[model samples]
Target: MIAKSPLRVLVAPNAFKGTFSAFEVASAMAAGVRRALPEAQITCLPLADGGDGFRATLVAAGGGRTSRHRASGPLLEPVWARVGWLPGRSGETAVIELASVAGLARIARPSPHTAATASTRGLGELIRAGLRGGPAEILVGIGGSASTDGGAGLARALGYRLLRADGCEIPEGGLGLRQLHRIESDRVDRRLAGVRVLAASDVTNRLLGRRGAAAVYGPQKGADRATVAGLEAGLHRLAEVAGRDLGTSGLEARPGAGAAGGTGFGLLAFCGARLFPGADLVANACGLDGALAQADLVLTGEGRFDRETVPKHCAIVSIAQRAAPNGPGSPGAL
Candidate 1:
């Protein structure tokens, strides 16, 4: 019954969380497959859900290059972050992951104070650097963020001024939103006018309410009950100001608006970026369907694979189903 010559095997897996990158996981799986079937033809396609390892996964799959820059961190400290680039017919396409610069991983020990003061200014600086390359499209992965600033700090870094009632600039982070303010966007980077921006996220929480960023993710970030309540109030105030001053109404209720501590709302409001599911965006960019077409046997895994491993909206599960033996035109079709 063992009549097979060479099996076309596809190995795709998410990162092992804090232990290994997606690339490393794929490589390890590929190696194991090679050991079992020396003649098997294996294709490695690492995947991510837009939390971390997003940039590396995309770059590896797309054959892109990585560039590093020193930018502001969650605590306004300096950190070296990476941006991915892939050259195309139209121009270069840039991939930026918020976790690279503004993620909670940057904080050694997260506390209520750290959560209260974390900022997204570094993310804006990174975007500016990406724009300097004259990219046709910018793909931003907004997840694993430490701050809940409603993107005010990011907007300010990109030239939008957040002025208080007294005409003074507010401090950084969610705490600053307590001051009633107006937004000025005349100074926003002109390069972004023609560039297309796409934000990839995994969550679909709105900007305010029980499922909002502050309520859903605040405790994990070290925000106490009172702090979470303050953040919710601040975000509500920010929504009002942004709606009035910048005309970005209705974003507060938009899905994924609360992602990355409301950086999703900021991108939609300030940069006009459209949000998409991170797994789907990454799958399309990596040409997963095309790879599956040629796969005789498809393999997918993560550090922990459980009932919750593949959510209803996860593209990875869809890919696996499409490549199943019972699926149409699969290599194992009878």
Candidate 2:
């Protein structure tokens, strides 16, 4: 008699950066899973921990569709980025990845040495595109950004105003932070409120600190020592202004606070969003638990799994393994 086939398995992993994208990694692992059990079912969920190539991963993993848009890049040029959606007749629901328009690829140099002149205005445009569809909310994936302007460009895209103390409009990019003093929101697009806002991120860095956006990530965005200091100062000022205007202590050190070049702070201040690890957000979006509930065994891996990956990068996998109803619930068991 033929042996019973092994049970179905789910393959999910984040992008490997320089090595393999999330899609490629999931595909490769699926191949291995198939090799081991040809008759068994295998599901591939190419995951993004709020990093590069998130849009494609979400589209592929969740049967979502994609559309292209032209948005501003780090260098002020028109760049092509895709927005993903879970296909349906419903008005509109979008999955946006910041890397599409304002990612590091647009930067001219490596961190601490490169320019932080990129703008997230393109992300704002993408959000606007989703809004045009009449969606209830836009889930924004914030990762791999190339800007340190605290989402000023994004604010501009949504019709919010950033101005200098003299009331002149601030220019785009991190450099503009130096002159910003007043923020005007009376003209902000009301359509933004029609849909709720959610930011997907994996980092926990605050808006300003030793572990803040500028000090921790400025080097990666081509900021030098002097630039980091200047950027930090600017971020502090932005936080202060937002705090004074909003009349709240605000969460400068909240977990995932240092996301998307401190765009996390802006979103919290302007959009009143709750942030989560990109993986957890995507997992819920894909019904990870539903899949795991049907599985007898599972397999998961990352590029170079380590201690840091457990809490920082691979936290989703760990969470899934723990939530699985197994007696000995641990990632190692999987």
Candidate 3:
């Protein structure tokens, strides 16, 4: 009889929301795998969907380092934010996750007033800091944001003057959008012109209308009906101005444009950034495909695994299915 080779196992998991992080989950799963297969070769790849844990996950996977900077929070308060750095052969890459600064989690309590006043200016500040490092690429994970200002605050942070009809700067947050009229990009940071900006998001909503950021996500952030309506109008005005001043028209209808309270739209319009699937971007950065190619068995999970877990859209499930013995590469079993 032929002897079988020891199993090569890969354990990759997403965070169990409201519980452990992806790194912690990966560690716990690795321990369980060790107990079950004492002699198996195990590999762990922690995963994220471009939200709260994105920076940590990528940094851990790439042996990158992190630096903290004081930035504005969702409520315009001072907060310490961390940016991940990954050195490459050519130049370094910076990973900036919006959750670190503008996430809803930063809010102690959700209220209509807080939702209306939340701003993504801090996220823009983080990006500006990252740019100072002279990175070749900036990977912005726009999820878990608390603002609906259409990236107006971000533009302001990067030196774009979002002025009112009277030529004065608007206030911060969604309410500020009401006064937004024109954008002056002449003062935008020159560094942005040389760096490639990529926005990671799974959202497909547009920047306006029913499926827009304010309409779909504002209520979740504590916005009332009236607040949502107001935010919607504000975002519409912002989009019109962005189109006219920045020549970035039709961005409001783009997929992922509504993510992070329309910060995605802001990034696209003002920074000339491109959008990508969060999972795919994270997976590639972690080299999951290479690991899958060598695995004989793969185990993947998240906090909740349900029928919504499909091979196409679900990150963990997709990784597992792709590593299956009958899957594309046909190398592993899951």
lDDT of candidate 2 at residue 300, scale 0 to 100 = 65
In candidate 1, the residue pairs with backbone N, CA or C atoms under 3 Å apart (3 or more residues apart, or in different chains) clash, namely none
Tell me how far the alpha carbon of residue 298 in candidate 3 is from the true structure, in angstroms, after superposition.
Answer: 2.7
Give TM per candidate. 0.91, 0.87, 0.91
Q: Report how far residue 6 has shifted in candidate 1, in Å.
A: 3.7
Tell me how candidate 3 scores on lDDT.
0.86
Residue-level lDDT tens digits of model 1 in 280-308: 88888788878888888777765655664
* Model 2 per-residue lDDT tens digits across residues 1-334: 9987667677766777657887888789889878878877887766677777677766776687888887777666888888788665654568888887778866655664334566778888888877777776677888888888787788888888888988888877776778778788888788887677888887777888898888878887788888888888777877777777655356776777678788887777777777877777767766777766656556665666655455563535544655555565322224
Ranking by lDDT: 3, 1, 2
Please, what is the whole-model Cα lDDT of each candidate in the order they appear? 0.85, 0.74, 0.86
Per-residue lDDT value at 185 in model 3: 88
In Å, residue 92's CA in model 3 sits off its true spot by: 1.2
Candidate 3 C-alpha lDDT tens digits along 1-334: 9988888888888777667888888799889989988999989888887786899988988999999999998888999999999989989999999988988888878989998889999989999999999999999989778888999888889999998889999989887788988889899999999999999985677899997899889998999999999999899889888889889989999988998899989999988999987888888888988988878777777777765345223467557545654556465434
Candidate 2 TM-score versus the reference: 0.87
